[model samples]
Target: MTHTIRRLLTGTALAAILAGPALADETIDITIVNGHPPIFLWVKHLTETFIPTVNAALEGSGYTINWTEAYGGTLAGVGGELDAVEDGLAEIGAIPTVFLPTKVPLQNVTYNTPFGPGEPQVVMEAMDALYAQIPGMAESWHQYDAEYLGGGFALDNYILMTNFPVTSIDDLAGHRIAAPGPAVNWLEGTGAVGVAGNLTTYYNDIQTGVFDGVIVFATAAAPARLHEVAPYVTVTGFGAQSAGALVANQTWLQDQPEAVQEALRAGAAAYQQAYIAEQTQRVAAAMATIAPDEAHLHTLSDAERARWAAALPDVAGTWAAAADGEGLPGTEVLNAYVQILRDAGVPLVRDWSQR
Candidate 1:
């Protein structure tokens, strides 16, 4: 009787040991620091669409991802977010790749060259496929000790909007224009004063006269009601951005069972596809409202656009140099990406690294 009782206790202990890790794998509590503004259309996708979709994907499997709102500064803010993730303040967060250009320069390769067609889907396709081929791409995340489970493209190309009437590039000079970081360099000789403002703040600031004009993309513009402040919109012929990634902490991910990893990958791809479709519809709806005269839907003239492209070399060079110091294959990967963009029919004035 004593021997039988001891054996039963030992068997129970062994069962507990075997079950603990698997149970932990089935449930994960991750906080998604909502990089987008709560009201923005993209936010809807992140909160309403993505969470439920990912949950459904993992439903029967008993695995789950818990995302909590950490809107911009509401939790970690722009600069400190990667640190927030690293320290485990929040298990997971959405970061804008552009915001941390110095810390994550390699991710911004698509932003430097802007001549690709501005559609969101194509830009997403190129970046997704591009990263899979580049060994350096995956390695970019490793240095930070994070795992890049998957990445999604950012909203498509940017558009120009202004509080007052502006018709031509000549009109852009001497205005208080808010430009996204890398593209801010593109605006240099054009004579626009660069004010560093992000999408989250642009709408409110634009209405209040913090800026007379803004360089922003359409997908976000409509939701922000940019038209209310800036009646004039210009669809600058440029590529969309691939600026979001779903990264997991290397420490945490390594301990997970193989089944959990597979589920996360599939969910990431689904989120990317849904975001692309959702954004495409929003951009179309936004574009439909403005009269042709008011919205100026046309590409920059070839000669003028050539001048714009010529201005990109310094921006790319500066970025590559910064990246190299971090021990990343910056110059090589940056140049290779540029060539890929060109080979795919993107327009280029000067190669950032090599043709």
Candidate 2:
């Protein structure tokens, strides 16, 4: 070939390569929203630990990020997360299924097997791996046209924080209790009336006796000052649920740079692992300061947990079936989660009928 022709060919190939990836610093813009107050303990984690970790992870890559944090309804409220992500109002958020049960039923499983495991690390890992393997999980997200970034861990299991004493199960009867989403189901046998409540309102609501008490865990209770209002904190041994998801718009995700995609996945994994580890020890340490004095704890015997488990419906099955019908592997994901939890020696709360 002539020299001119060879030069032209080389120029075209270089242009194509440059157009492909172009090793250029890219700025990724996303929004982080939460319904709870900025001072809420869980919110602190999302702002402090999670966001910084993400920025640090991308530091050397010359990848710039613009994170717009809109909390306390600046963007959306607790029940509005699914729509926000689906509608492209926000990019990253911590949504509670307890708040949006209709949008995400599989999430209710987080509360269903409430008394699953005590340790945060174990529960976090169990749910994380479980969601990935479970059938129909992704399908549920796709229904809203979104993707899951995989931090399926949470603050802690639901505890009963009340102004009154709860030394026995019978004590919960005839009282009004607040729980998230389907968690109202867990309070059924106790004969207590369940109401919808979130972390932002529980402290004041409990103090005012709007509800006799709120069902939540230490990681959340501390910041909300539940110990001050409801001094009695019951250690129900319920595992934590998914705190927040590093979700992306399904359409936007497909357009992200491959490097950005990998970074996003790795960042979520690191955040989940680090958050679970810190929360496990933080909760115990937080409780240690209040135990045997200001606050009360109740641990169910293996027999008692079994009784509770037996009483509850097969929520996992219900969820998996729904997701399966929607073409998501809800069943498989749930089963794989149970296996991982079992292998980790995390206590099995119940076997969903779908299994």
Best by the lDDT measure: 2
Candidate 1, lDDT over the whole model: 0.70
Tell me the lDDT of model 2 at 78: 71
Pull out the clashing pairs in model 1.
Answer: 159-216
TM-score attained by model 2: 0.82
TM-score of each: 0.84, 0.82
CA lDDT of each prediction against the hidden true structure? 0.70, 0.70
The deviation in Å at residue 145 for candidate 2 is: 2.2
- Candidate 2 least-lDDT 10 residues: 286-295
Clash count list over all predictions: 1, 14
TM-score of 1: 0.84
> What are the root-mean-square deviations of the candidates from the true structure over C-alphas?
5.5, 6.6
